[model samples]
Target: MQTINCPRLIERVMANTLESIMISDRRGRIIKVNNAFTRITGYSESEALGQTPAMLRSERHPPSFYAAMRAEIDHRGSWSGEVWNRRKTGEIYLQWLSINALEDEKGYVSHYVAISHDLSELRAREAEVEFLAFNDPLTRLGNRQLLMNRLDQALASCREKGEVLGLMVLDVGRLRPINDHFGMRAGDEVICTQAERLHLLAEASDTLVRLQGDTFALLRHSQASVADMTHLAERIIKDLSRGITLQDKSLLMRPSLGIALFPQDAMNKENLIQAAESAQMQAKSQGRKMFRFFDHGQHSEQQRQLIIEHDLGELIIARKHTGLELYYQPKMCLVSQTVCGAEALLRWQHPSLGWISPGEFIPVAEQTHLCVRLDRWVIKQALQQIKSWQQQGVDVPSIAVNLSAHQLDQEDFASWLASEVAHEGLNPSVIQLEITEGAMIRNGEAAVALLEQLQGQGFSISLDDFGTGYSSLSYLDSLPLNELKIDRSFLQRIDRDERSLKLLRAIAGLALSLDLQVVVEGVETDRQVALLSQFGHIKVQGFYFYRPLPAAEFRELLDLQ
Candidate 1:
């Protein structure tokens, strides 16, 4: 190597460096400071020399903190961190400081060289950009970006403190319908109303964020337990469920609240959101006007549902051969014990996992939009079964398969049903499509009028879960329905609860007055059966007799008795 002037090269490099490098003697007096030091810190070497380094201390740092830093540098020979310091003219700035101990020939401490970079403008720019990026323009609350950041910070805090934080995903419910039905001006008014409500709901320390599409998030630094979060969730439900008035017409806006708590729901940001979102999803799935907290089982259950959603299409293809099977539970005449029909339930017999219940896969099918295909399969299978039973000298009434709302939403719904029944060469009267009372509703007159065509096709229609829907009795009076099935929930409580008994009696009386047959469900006890029998409306089914049984088992029963 060429001969090099090592000491001169080091001094020149230090003088030109972007950072301010200064040397202080063991007594803490500045011995020398470089040109960069004068330029950035606004102090000339003549002015800074011989002065104590204390002149640069901003006093924001605790005395003990500096003492500890000095101790670390004395023991370890170097220290690095962001610190507050003062420049000339008393301007305070953030400084990234790094100090290295200068050694003597004998390894004794000789002096120290500290390099500092001014961070004032940089920090200000950062804060401004962060605010622009993460704050909502309208409400000035945290936007989705800040909500995400807040969640991350909360996750980190939870990791350190071992406490749970709760996230409430709030949806502004009535805002959309009002905006759509009324006007955009009404929408803005509704949003402002909700933003004010959100501000009032949150503690001063808590962050309320405006997520997109009129949704908001309220973040809580919950206590160690989730009980506190649950109590808060209930309070939100009660508050948001109250009515709001616009132009003196009462409008209802309820939150579909989903909560996620740390450690219990999830440990990380993504997972915590998913847990909260999963709970909220469950709430919305149940009809979206209440609070739902994350349950461990719900998390695992959602995972299982996701797996089914992804894999069910493939599962359907594989099972299309030998694994696909249908089970039917009999719906009998109340007193005759004669089967009126059966509801088809899909079962998957995995080669390794054995049978999978409809309860497990049906929801998955619904979520993945696979239910339409599954429904098609059920229709073909049920008609074939009815044909087989008819040929075997056993009388089987019409077959019923539960129709999902998505199934009805298909553009070819009535045509598809007609085509499927025709392709199966089955009598239209032998097949009945059971639509939930909720799903049977149509917003457009064209949609409800479409159902009138289905009624003309020699097919029977039954209103499922007749009492648990939004339609008034007057609305029901206009619809053509051959039968009405009382929800299992009402009849199950009739034997023990007076309120339920009266509700059931009223429903039975109304169905009869409308010239409709009523089917009571969930008759698990003989007393329940006797009560329905006494009322002369004994058409029922539940665990009292049998859960759904496979075709083979049900066929064998037909042979035995």
Candidate 2:
């Protein structure tokens, strides 16, 4: 049977199709033109018949572009693409084009035909869609898809270059409070501000991508060293640590970072991302405002995490094993030099570790989603204790109960506080909620909104560890904060360091100006107490007055006072 030939059909389609079609000699000069060519170029057959298609080149592409394109066609005998071309009216339009070589008889002589369709409108629409798809609405940074695409490209480039590509992934610490407690509008401000902060921290060559929610991805072509990565991460942490004043409220920053290096920790794109993510999980597990690197012994770390997770779950729910105890430290009145109030701090008496510091177990509980229960328990216990003190006619000033960023992120924490107060038959204002300044800033918008909500409900908020953070005073002015507790470090140095006294004076002065109550923590001696007196009307808590005592011992101390 004779084979059916297709070249004749190709010729007919190229010569008469709707798409602009042209025939050229082997040298690429136009030898013939179709009707659609005249229609698209706004030139009659006479004007385009012999003119080369290059005459329609819009100059958007470089000269070398056409040269390389021609070379490809010469070597392969065909080319197809979307290229910009100019109409006779001088308007630049995009064209979807296809070209093929035609040969006859001995297959030694040749001609080429090109078919093109207008694609300008399609391209414009695609661009608009692409923008929406690849960017975060609030931050205007690359979203997850864009970040992954870039990571893929960076991995490919790293493989080609035989160099290490560093990936720095950051999770804004304490950001959940802003989004969960405050409305999303307030949370948007935090996210937007973070983008600006990251832009300044990342090198010019690095790509900064916002990876959905509070996560960000940074890709560097080459890392100078581990120190350089750490320096960059620190810059990000410090910049974001600055107070965020939104509307009438303010917030602080807290973040955690993880890093993975290409060709070192991982070579493939998936492995690189997994390593970075694993490191991030480790950072989050440690606490916010921390950085960690990928460890090859990921399985062991995972096993450790599993054990901690198991213990945390059991600790929160299993009251039989959980040695939940409340500790009290007296807060002294600066002028009177006597105990005016006390901070109710939580301590876990681990049957194994003897005393598990709040620092360790709190973070573990928060990450494992056990903090909600633990925080609720602490609040209830504190409120009940305060109510009991009041019932005994102890008439103590408000008892301060510290709150965690994770606790504020809980949807019902504020209302839960209200219920706890009502349950204990105590005034909401009698229990002041203390949160770290670092938590406030990192959670900027969310924390501020939550503060206002909790404040509006008659609960008091205190800026804990005031001067040690970026700016607790600024947040105090914006948030409905009732007190500013000077960090223990500042007070410890007060007697020996004049600078600290002056600094404490400045903070106290600012607190007075803003009508905020001032409290100095960790005052250990008569000399420290005398030095702190210069600050005026400040409340003090330290071993100099009394160490953190258990409930029974604290109640006895309360009777004595």
Query: Residue 37 lDDT in model 1?
Result: 86
- Provide the global lDDT of candidate 1 against the true structure: 0.78
* Candidate with the greatest lDDT versus the true structure: 2
- Candidate 1 TM-score over all chains jointly: 0.49
Candidate 2 shows a clash count of 12
Estimate candidate 1's RMSD in Å.
11.5
The alpha-carbon lDDT assigned to residue 301 of candidate 1 equals 68
State model 2's lDDT: 0.79
Residue-wise C-alpha lDDT for candidate 2, range 18-61, written one tens digit per residue:
88888888777787777778888887778876678878989999
lDDT of 1 by residue, 1-561 (tens): 899899999889987888899899977789989898898778899999999878888899999989999899989999999999887978888989999998899988899989889887899999878887988767778887887888788778877877778788877686778887878887777777778877877788687888876777888864635677677667777777777777778887767888877777677778877777788878878887787888788678677666666567886655553577888887878767766667777778766556777778787787778887788778888888877887888766667787777777777878888887787677788887777766766434544665677789877777787767774666457766767778888875776798988878877778778888777777788888877776675478787877888897777656654
